[model samples]
Target: MTFWALLILTALLIAAFLGYAMFRGRKNREPAAAYDLRVYREQLAGVDRDLARGVVSEADAERVRTEISRRILAADAQMQAQTDQDGPPLWANVVAISVVAAVLVGGGFWMYRQMGAAGLPDQPLELRKEMAEALRADRPSQAQVEADLPAAPQPQLDESYAALLEQLRETVSARPDDLQGHILLAQHEANAGNFRAAYAAQQRVIELSGDAAPADAYSHLAEMMILSANGYVSPEAEEALKQALQRDPRHGPANYYLGQMMVQVGRPDIGYRIWIDALRVAPPGAPWVEAIYAQLDDLAFRAGVFNPPNIPAPSGPSREDIDAAAALTPEERQEMIQGMVNQLSDRLATEGGPVEDWAQLIAALGVLGEGQRAIDIMKEAVDIFAGDTEALELLDAAAFQAGIAQ
Candidate 1:
């Protein structure tokens, strides 16, 4: 109900109460005048009979009858006045009812029109449900996103990464005899952030090399495995590298890799010991000397127990060391050193480090008295090297020695 409707209803209720009060109030306002008409008539008739029977004087009867008639007339006039006092007007009642009805209907219609004009919509369950669903559907899972990815052309980096992986796989599979291929595959996998896969590939190389020439393969595989292990090298991998070290106590790569692994695993003392061993075994002009120095500095910083002085700047091969190596006769030294170098280089080719691994394989073949195989390996290396002068010269010399050239 509107304000106007409430006001009108209140007015109607008040009027009705007032009317009832008037009706009730009027009940006891006038006193009761017991003018019993039947008693008056009977008493008058008895007086007349007495007058007729000469039982009473005429004057007395006449006076009594006149007094009784006066009382009756007064009573009738008072009753008429009482009946006409203070009744509610019919016109007033009709007007009040009209006003109440008008207020109720008019207020209701006006409110309805105002609300409609303002576009006050009703609450919709369907719209609320749809909004909830839309909010929930906006977010998708990783698997869902991957599934919805379009067949669009890949970016250059992605394409190159995929091609590199495919080439590595093909090279590994096609050239099982080529240890260098497996090594390259492992290196590429490492570069691509697949450390586990790289470690697995190196492990295969170690397995293939067997006991005869496992030093370099063990070194490479141990390096990758330790790197993959992060700061906690597995006991299994650690033991494998130690076994390799025992076989060739002066194996430079194995010692260096193991030292690095030890440092990573929070064994700085052991790492330092292994690094010292590495320095002693590695040649004067070894290629990895600078890398070893950096590792030592890192381990020392992490240990925090005692600060060690920086390793002295690396120097070239000492004159004394060169002179001592040169003192031996060329033929005898070549024959002896060639055997060691061939074994080491063949291991390097299998473990996959340098691009010149194919040439190393050729060198090893020639040293092992397989001249024809050496010639073929050299040709393959030349084909791979293409415009490289060193590879061309090496290939020509090997071919001449094998009697396969003019």
Candidate 2:
């Protein structure tokens, strides 16, 4: 129904309900003077009975009888005056009631209307979905997503580094199917400022890893592409980043570039958010740490973002933990991971955290090969962030990492 029609109907209904109550009250009401006189007469009869039973002194009885008689005479006189004057005037009562009814009904409707949509038509779920889809359609296309990251820092390539790169390349060429060989070649090439070579090796690594490849493979590919192009996030590079995210949403290299992509697309808030999350969860000695911070510091300065001179850095796997884990067997590693996951899961279940935190925990479980635990955590995360698109996207990334989703 239209707003005005509904409002009017509600007001009328309230008015009718109140009017009926008023009418019922009037129908059941007795004449006030008659009722009062009857009550007084009963009191006088009680006093007479008390005096006959000698329950009162004669003097007290006389005084009580006199007071009662006086009150009865006054009531009888008032009743006579009321009869001669006719009944009470009703228009005053009606006018008072009408004003009260109008104030109550109108004021109530006005207050209720203030809290609601008021004049807007109610939108059904289907229409809202269409509108959201249209909005997404208007956003930048896949090709337009750019990283716009700063150029990778370069230092003079020492002779030893050059020799090492050539040696790594020869070793990789000799064993084309060796995944670790390709990965090492890609890393050394990128370190020696041969991003093109790095890109080629990263591609080979992905090829060797095949369909079962994790996000790191694609992430490395994306990074090399950007570095090769002097840090321009091209369409191909963006696609590589997409694939990396498809497998692991919070993959360090991929997220770092993608967040820069958001910045390039004029979404500083998203970039800042993702970068902050990456910074928070990054390993203590991870190579991407400085680069991520460099862009963030610049972005914060440009935007006048107020931050402390030194924000305390996030803690991650300590050296001791790694050393201890390295000493343990694979089965022992599984047990440790399960213990950590249990603690994290219990904490998150009792005291919830942000979307990315949940994603990180799920990713950790997936890395540990705890498929069931990862799935359970994913379900809980989805329930916690239900209907939140950004939250759901983060969760989907975690799920993919966990193999809970394709």
Candidate 3:
């Protein structure tokens, strides 16, 4: 039945029940009718005997008999009035009980009709089958589901990268003497976003290559060091850079990175010279040459030095202008390059030429709360090179200038 229908029926049933109770109370009369004549006579006789024996006065005896009669008559009249009222028949009571039972059963069934068999506790076997079907909908048949489920869903990237790093580690461990393996492992670690492991792996490469060979090993080591030093650099990684540099002074990456590290640790002049030397030895169009040159520019900028001084502009067409006074000679390129080097040297000699120049500028600017400028200069360097010494030196200088270093 609808909710309203059930409510109306319940109210009617309650009213009927109350009416029946009231009816039964009226019909099942107490023994309030007149007392039996035999009992009354006996009681009156006993009272009379008492009066005759002088235990009571005739007036008192009469009063007691009269009072008792009055009470008995009042009780009998009340009982007879009660017996005259209406009451439920036995059949009516039985029907009410059947009606209540039917209401309860029908109401329960109506509510249960809204529920599905999926919710039935006795149908667990069916529920399992449904769940298996759901899984099959999303997964390929060939893919195996584990007998034991995971506590929660795992990130695919997290799992994939973690596995890659693990494989790289195993490869490096198995081939301890393979410098290339270490380099590959380091790159793998870097790709997997594990900078610390990458740094360590690069350090291993430097160690395997030793002092004389593998010019790029030091450079890679320096890259790792710079990355590590940016809160990314670890002490162990720093040690690795040191080892790489120890293997070769002219190792381009090593010299550049170590020089920057040195400046970060408060040796800007050495850092500047190292960067300059890196630029000098680096071949044009070499893999890392542009990066080295950018670092030099960055260093000059941070030192508050702009362009180099006293290099006459090229006099003729690009090729001829770069040549020497001897027209037939191939000295133009050499002269132009020398002029460029001289220009770099002159700029280095100015107020903000080298590490010391940057240090002074950073300090002076810091005192004036020009930290943004200092930071700007450093950022410019970072923009030009991935891991340059000049950039590192400026980072250190800025930090020191800002009173970050103790």
Candidate 4:
């Protein structure tokens, strides 16, 4: 009420000031012709005084008086002609002032209504952090969120593939202890958008592997859970992520999901930092890398970073190296390739390259029949790109060629 009263008083005072200025201007305004007429009349009176004091002859006084009277008549005529043209009419001036006042007051109110938070009080940083914490603490559980979600759309599958999938499912159900069968079932179920079944199969895979289950198994389970819940990270998924990180602390999927969970829980600062770290090591074309790149700016803004630093693209072999290798003889080419691979290895050890370079090196080592060396590099690459589905696929292909992956 007090604010409203003050606003109204301020507006009225402004309008009154403008009105007074206009009225005073009109009242004080004297036409140029009218001022000239007044000056001419004063000069005529001076001439009469001069004649009475004998300071001028009669003829001179009469001539001066005639000339002054002629000037006064012309000035009077010009003033009469300018009377209506001097300024806008009183009513028009009033309307103009009223419109300006109305726009000043009413437009300001309209603009405020559109952009201002009328009822909300200003929140300090500490208070905002406290509120965010409270919101995080009171957020809905996984089950609750899943219950509210609509059914997922089923993916279209060819009849042949569907029949094969059904057979695989039946075989896995009957065998129960077949680790390979469960892995296949999990992969195919996830491909078919049957996340619930996918996660169940993945859980069985983990159970069968027991303490030997790799970080990927747990991460895959968490991924399925998240997909089933439409991207919501449940306590169940978080536990899986924790298990994955325990086995391989740099697991990509686990870190990505962890960052997502942080953002969902009103901790964008933590989320942004986690994502930035992940992106630094992520291979080019990795699914998580692309996803993070797409949303990084928005995430940074929410994290209160107005200008986030750019993430450099991963470097690979130069065209000159490729052209030089291509020009070599067969035996020389092998030697050149080995030299290039050695250089790449040394460079990666000193300053890491993109996942593509890592993949290429692994493939090149396998081609050179360096099985053990390839296997060792594959292990290190796996740890670096853990949980990143696409990057893992590339590394797995290179490992397979090297006879290191089954």
Candidate 5:
């Protein structure tokens, strides 16, 4: 109503201005004959005055007076003829002003209505951000967006698994305090895609373990929720993640999931750091390392990470260096250490060695203050061992001692 009122007011103001201009024009548009008559009268009086002042000869003044008299007669005849006819009615101006006002006001609103969303409240910035994040997550991982893996396939329940699962559920219910039984039931429930059941059983696992409960229970519960929703990170899943991190800040799955969550929630820098840490500590051949390797660099680029330090690969000190270091002179030790470092690095680069050798190189680099080189070695080792848990642990210890991150 207010919008309409403003438009109406604007239209009226414009119409009133136009109408005044039109009326003034009409008033000023006097017959041309009247103007000519006034000019002739002024000229006739001027002729008399000029003659008296001796500015003009009497014969010349007389000739001017005769010509001026002819013009005056013609003007008088024109004015008499004009007065006999009528001019346009006053209503014609009012009609024109009304049409102009209506057209301008109605056209303006019509065009606006055609082009704009009428009466929709604006979305808040936070809500807009959430929407954008959701859209981004739905897109491909590394290819375009954050959700890297294809939606995990929903687990199908086979007849044998289903029968066993039902029997396990009955046993768990009967022996509520049996932690192992509850754990087994929870695992089976998750396998069968019964997420809420899995969630309940995992909760029992946490309850049974009490203060001794590992962070993995909470993290696993979160994973169940996410899988249930086809990778949607809901409030319940987030709460579970919080519990996991609270119990163990560096829990492998917890860190990986939380880091991915950070990426999902538009904190890619935090996400990148989290995933990188997880990748460093994760056992060789872990799934999270692959996901991180495949996706994190792309995420870092998007986050605009400044000065992103050139962290080196993982390598460590060899046993030979350890055995010889105490006996050799400082200069001899330095040369021997350099020789071993060069050999290890060349072998790792050209013909990748065992996990222990990679760890040795990484640790050696760390001791030499080649932190960047150690980090780079670790990055390469993740792929070489990809999922070897034992090798990954060795590299992790070597990286830890060499002060890899520092």
Candidate 6:
């Protein structure tokens, strides 16, 4: 109210001052013709004085007086003409003042509506933090989110595999306290595209392990929960991610999901920081590296980061290798590829490499028509990257190319 009152009052005052100046200027002005008439009359009086003092000849004085009289007549005629043509009417001034006042006040209000925070209250740092906390606390639970989601399409299964999966499920149900049974059930359920069941089984496994459960167990649980919810990080999944981070602060899967949860909860600043730190220390083919790279620009923008660090591309087969392969005959190329694959396999077995090496080996084996070998390597890679969703996805793509079950 005070802001509005001050703005209106200032505008009115300026308009009134301008209108007064216009009227006062006209009133104070002496007409040009009137001034000219007075000067000419003074010259005529000087000519008369000159004649009386005998300072000039009578003819010279008479000629001066006639010229002065003629100038006086012309000046008087101009003054009368000016008086007949008066200044503008008073109503015209009033209308102009009203327009100026309206424009000043109305234009100011329009500009404020476009650019000012007319109604919003100021938000301090503490208030924003409190709002974020409230948002986090109000997120939906896993079950609630899942309930609202559309039913997932069921995968088609061979009769024998279906029977085996059913038998395993029955066995796990019978032996409720068996940790290994629960773990196997979780793995089989997830493989069969039954994520809800998979998470439930994983939860049981964590319960059986109690304090002995590793970060991977909690991370796996979160992964299954998120998948079941179609990529939404529910409150339960966030709790699992928290537990995983509590166990191993550098756990890749946990950190990735934690960042995602922070973004969902309207804390992109924290999410950007978490993802940046994770990417810095992450291996070339760490599961979350690609995901982080994809979202880095948007995350930086939301976090108000104008200049972000460059994200290096993931490592892959060298250009030299491709050129060498291109120069070889078909038989020679096959031999060279096989030799390279064998060397990679040997090196990975002797000293475990990043997940990229394992994926590359699987793909190479598939290209060489060694489907069984590719399948074997994929199984091993899956075990190594159990809780990592992105790594598993890479391995799955390799397996699909190898004509193996995902």
TM-score of each: 0.35, 0.37, 0.31, 0.56, 0.40, 0.54
Candidate 4 residue pairs in backbone clash: 252-386
Alpha-carbon lDDT, every model: 0.60, 0.73, 0.54, 0.82, 0.74, 0.82
Clashing pairs in 6: none
Sequence-dependent TM-score of model 6: 0.54
Q: Candidate 1 lDDT (Cα, whole model)? A: 0.60
Stretches off by above 4 angstroms in model 4 are 1-116, 313-406
Per-residue lDDT tens digits of candidate 2, residues 1-406?
5766777677777777877777666667665777878888898888889988999888988898789789888877877776433334567557767887688668877887787666677887667556545643455432343233344566577788777777878887898887767766776777677787788888887787688666766887888887676656666777898998887666788888987766665555567777777777675545577677657777775445777245445455666987999999989988888888788788899998888779878888866767788888888889989999878877875665454564
Over 1-406, each residue of candidate 5 has an lDDT whose tens digit, in order, gives 6766776688778878887888788777788788899999999999999999999999999999999999999999888888532467778877887888788778767876787565666887678577657854564432222244455556667788778888988988899998768776776787677776787888887788787555667887888777666676665677788887886676677787787777777767678888777766665434456656667668879667756655443333345856768889989988887887998799779987778678778878877868788898888897888788767766765665355522
Residues 49-112, candidate 4: write the lDDT tens digits: 9999999999999999999989999988887787554688889999989987897788767876
Task: Quote the positional error of residue 364 for candidate 1 in Å.
Answer: 16
Ranking by lDDT: 6, 4, 5, 2, 1, 3
Worst 10 residues of 2 by lDDT: 140-149
Model 3 spans > 4 angstroms off: 1-165, 170-181, 203-215, 231-247, 292-298, 301-406
Where model 1 places Cα greater than 4 Å from the true spot, the runs are 1-161, 170-181, 261-267, 285-287, 295-312, 316-406
Per-residue lDDT of model 6, residues 236-294, tens digit only: 99989999888768777789988988888888999999988887777665647777877
Those runs of model 5 whose alpha carbons end farther than 4 Å from true positions after fitting are 1-155, 306-406
Candidate 4 vs candidate 6: which has greater TM-score? 4
lDDT of 3 at 398: 43
Residue range 9-62, candidate 1, lDDT tens digits = 666666566656655665534434434555667788888999999988999889
Q: What's the lDDT for residue 155 in model 6? A: 85
Question: Candidate 5, after superposition: displacement of residue 336 in Å?
Answer: 41
For model 4 the local lDDT of residue 386 reads 88
